[model samples]
Target: MSAFESIPHFDDSRAAAGQQARVEDTRIAAQQFRQHMLNGPKVRYFESFDLITVPYPVRYGLRNAFSRERFVEYMHIQNRLFVVQFDTPDGLKTLLVSPSDHERNIETPFFRRLQDRTAAWLTKLIIKRQSSVPQILERIGLRPEDVDYITYDHLHTQDVRRWLGTDKTPGLLPNATLLVHWREWESAKDLNPYQADWYCPGGIAGIPESKVIGFDGSIMLGDGVALMHTPGHTEGNHSIVVHTDEGLWVTSENGVSVDAYAPLLSTASGVADYAKMIGTEVIINGNTLENAVDQYISMVQEATVAGPSRRDPRFPNVFPSSEMTPFWMFPGTRPAFYVGHARHGTLQRP
Candidate 1:
């Protein structure tokens, strides 16, 4: 069944999108509480699993946004993708952030495939050592039906068709619904030329609507797991926040590294030096046309949610999902930033 035939459609423009988001968030809260009294303040806790690590070219991600010698030069840095399993008001749920599953995505939409093929052979050096969602699920002794939801901070270069299934391909996550910000979904419908290369051509088309979920502003999937609108990287970009026993950890490329997120309060990462030298507290991921104003606000939102780490009062509780390492030094097979205790166990019920 095509999305057009089955799913209910709600459309909004960028100008009015924020208001719509607030409305949606409030509505979701009321419904969640009424149905399942996971109410008032929540003692949030969850275990995070590393799903995959994507080795990406430096210039493509950080946008030469750092003061590192490599930013002045050129290189590639790898980022991580992870899954968080936690107890929700409804039941046990797994929330996946950044499903960069396909490495040699030969099935990429035609025009994009052509561009990638030419780039790979000629100019750019793009290397992706990836593990598919199914592979990770199996490793964890679970399946597609085991996950409750799948989402991304933004839809940069992502092909929803792979997960949602195209006319030819069966939906990979049969029981899981794809959650996205309404504005991000709108951008996919009509994207600017700059983002053309990253996104799959007609990627969102023809998917079953019933399998997709769109939200505005910030929303709680249940206690401990929430999707917050943390724009700047992309107009519709968002961050997934989960409260573990340790604290809240946010997943988004808004800032390439932990230092990028808290430049003022951190000096652990090299980018922090750049921010200090420049006398500017705010730092963006460096790629994609960004709204610096929006990014500044978003960082604060992330930090506020994170509060202070119990481990260290000096640092905010928040950590980078995509920890930016100095590409020149550790060029291959680096670790991803993750949070809380983790396990690859079978899905839990009630």
Candidate 2:
């Protein structure tokens, strides 16, 4: 029997009870996460509503099947939204991260084809278990239009327009500058071909190349905020390090979850690129194997630490790797305290 068939009937009271228990478990987990953040070393933290949940099958389909799988998944997946606020000597500075505006449907023909295939598979699996997609949605109580203007770790095509709108809004503290990782804005073409139609000639192209800041090892964005290049996943990936009265806080664009820091397996089955494979292995391991497998792992880890940092003023190349700091914001981690520092050097309280 398939994995779906091994479970109890969907309508069974026991199964229903189990589902309720799962929901409660998720809520408890979220609550604990918030409480942990509140008690962390940081001075203050702000959280927004959790609007949407990207279905696992859909996430899998997009990441493995989409043309620009990595970029797409990095920008839009598991749609949760939140913003963190820190207290600085200057006042209150907010670090907006991980705010997803909307759940997108695959509109292009290529994506549509892949979606159709996955939908068919989902239909069979779900129907076999006497349930439907809507039923699952009902269980989760997710709304399509639930979100806030928080800084997101990943930004998709839609996010750019929304950002522009937000930036142009009048009477808001003009001091707030959108702190973008220098690399994300630079390597748009190589990372996402679909975005080429928009980001290429007329969009980012319209902005003078002179305004683009390539990777500097680190740059003070005024008021103690810093932009650091932490490359690995892509040439353009970077991290934002903000210095507050409380402490130094770093926000990474591609730094999704703690698991992302762990070693990744090869991507050889669906879309295979030998160069990417070698490069990825080298990045993860630091160099080609010259010893036993375990020894090689150790060598890679060391190399990863000792490798030369890559930062180009014109290209947005930042750092030796994306995993710069070992610390992560998990459920039980302590928060840091710091003073407010704006992206453009102005200090403000919100």
Candidate 3:
């Protein structure tokens, strides 16, 4: 049986009490996690791929950057794949988090409809040959069979058939199981109109049930690693949490950079001013406004769990899986602070 634990208290309600309750619950969970697992075996982390740079709406990113003509229309986001390895009671475990298949990802309706060959030219120009996951795995001396689990924060623009295989095609990872939340798994297979824009159609189709693990609530893979449901970006969105010598670090796509988590500490041109003007603690990614209140509270939970960054104590260690990287193409949208890649411990072959 898998280690399944009830999520302490998750209140996504719009009431003020629900908001405060969420914050308190998250703080309590953070305390317990640190107390019990802070010194547990550290996971070996590596940035498996730099992946791709895509345009993101500025209004969705900074929220207040909406009417500002000086700011770029879109922010260039660099999505990355992370390889995390750790020892568990069962055995040595390797998890591929956010292992996005870029070429297949473009099949999402939003990108597919972009005409004038813009998408094709951009893909040829921006995608780097060496940044493919297969190459990175080989370079790091890991075989396809070495991966035990594959997961993403949410399944937006992701087509897992390439990795997990269908009836006709062979899978890239022969022995890997896809670990995902039950809600997310269901939503991707049968998307609502509200969700149609971002998700790739037929993304999760045709995989044998045995090859997938559909879980609910928060789960501890082992030691200091956790998959906690943070929601808001999507209903089933969760954050990857890790404990290292430095401190706890959380990864998700709720926010694009350090500026979103700690807007007051942001040196980005208008981020701090906007947050101060609105009297809000954190900024939402705003791409989907369906559940802004829930998204707002989820960001608080992530920041609480991540604690402070050793590099910059003023900011929390809540990193974005698709981070906002500096691009000359979009000059004014550069993130004042970005955690380019997080590497911890050494990768030991199992």
Candidate 4:
């Protein structure tokens, strides 16, 4: 038997000490993360939000999901998995967005084979130890049970069945429910042939129906949060809108960088200007299976829903949700902005 499996009891002093160290380490990590969110450099690509925060996986510190030439105009970017928490009457309602593929075991034949052919830049981004969602949660002081709902902008390269469990196995988050758009959920179930390589095979297959909650259109999840349909990249693509002290911050892969969303203000002015001159607004092509017209429309929706850009010169409150970058680059290191004071939008009491 393995040494871990052979442990007879849970009360061993060494084990207890290890547990304590883990918790303590996690607490320290959380504190540092809070600082990073507050103090990280406010890249033009990101608009600062006072209410919403990135509570876990401070930085993946890897390159863009897209390759070298895919986004040639851009220099480098990093992918970030954000644990966005919102304050609500029901208590702290947590939403886990863009949770990356944490179940990819590097030791497996699949990873081994892929790694042999994988580019050097992607190697650091897909490290197995850091990619496991369960370990990530533990490191961030979040009990999987604490997650009320989990969803992604789309179903690209996801393996959520592991999180939701099957008929025989239990899900990692016992109390959590997956909130997915109906179209997106269906698209995942019936992946297109051309997009086969982009999605996780059987990502959502065989999950208990009770664990999935499908929404038809835009649904408000109480206390300054809402899910809105923004399809263009994929038929089921959507973005999460959070009302923060700085205004609305959206989470999506539709626009890879702030420049994609706001071309006029981006560094790629020559190209952005040319596109606008011709009536086409340039946005990052998230999923190849997309409609340019639809993508333009979706980007408009995101801009419209987002709160007004700030006037402060130090850091304007507007940015792309995640920074997608190539290797040899790191994510923003600014400290957390919204400490404990997240001014959520409220409704008129009838």
The CA lDDT of each predicted structure is 0.56, 0.30, 0.77, 0.51
lDDT per residue for candidate 1 within 1-350, as digits (tens), equals 11112111112212334744533443343234222322333323344444334344445344434344443433333445567676654666766677664453333343345445565643233443545666766775767777667788887766677677866778777777788888888888887777655676666788777877877666666655667777777888887766554555556777665555556554432445556676654466655665755665566556655655566565555656555544443342122332333333334433
Candidate 3 or 4, higher lDDT? 3
**Going through the candidates in order, what is the number of backbone clashes in each?**
2, 26, 0, 31
Local accuracy of candidate 2 as per-residue lDDT tens digits, 1-350:
01011111112212224634533343343234323333434434432233432222213321232234333332222333334444444455554444322323233333344446666765343221222222322443422121111232222322323222332332121222344445556555354554332222322223323322343333333233434333433343334433333333444424222222222322322222432443333222111111223222222222222222122111111111111221121111111111122222232332
Best by lDDT: 3
Candidate closer to the true structure by TM-score (higher is better), 3 or 4: 3
Error of 4 at 60 (Å): 21
lDDT of 2 at 115: 48
- Each candidate structure's TM-score, on Cα atoms with residue i matched to residue i, is 0.72, 0.38, 0.91, 0.64
Off by over 4 Å in 1: 1-65, 68-76, 104-130, 264-270, 326-350
lDDT of 3 by residue, 194-268 (tens): 687889888888887877888887787875688888778888888888877667878899898878998877765
The global Cα lDDT (0 to 1) of model 1 is 0.56
lDDT of 3 at 28: 68
Q: Lowest summed lDDT over 10 consecutive residues: which window, candidate 2?
A: 1-10
Candidate 2 lands at a TM-score of 0.38
Deviation of model 2 at 206, angstroms: 8.1
Question: Taking the tens digit of each residue's C-alpha lDDT, what string does model 4 give over 204-307?
Answer: 77889898888765565654565666676787787776655565566676765555555444433243444455544444554453654555556655655553
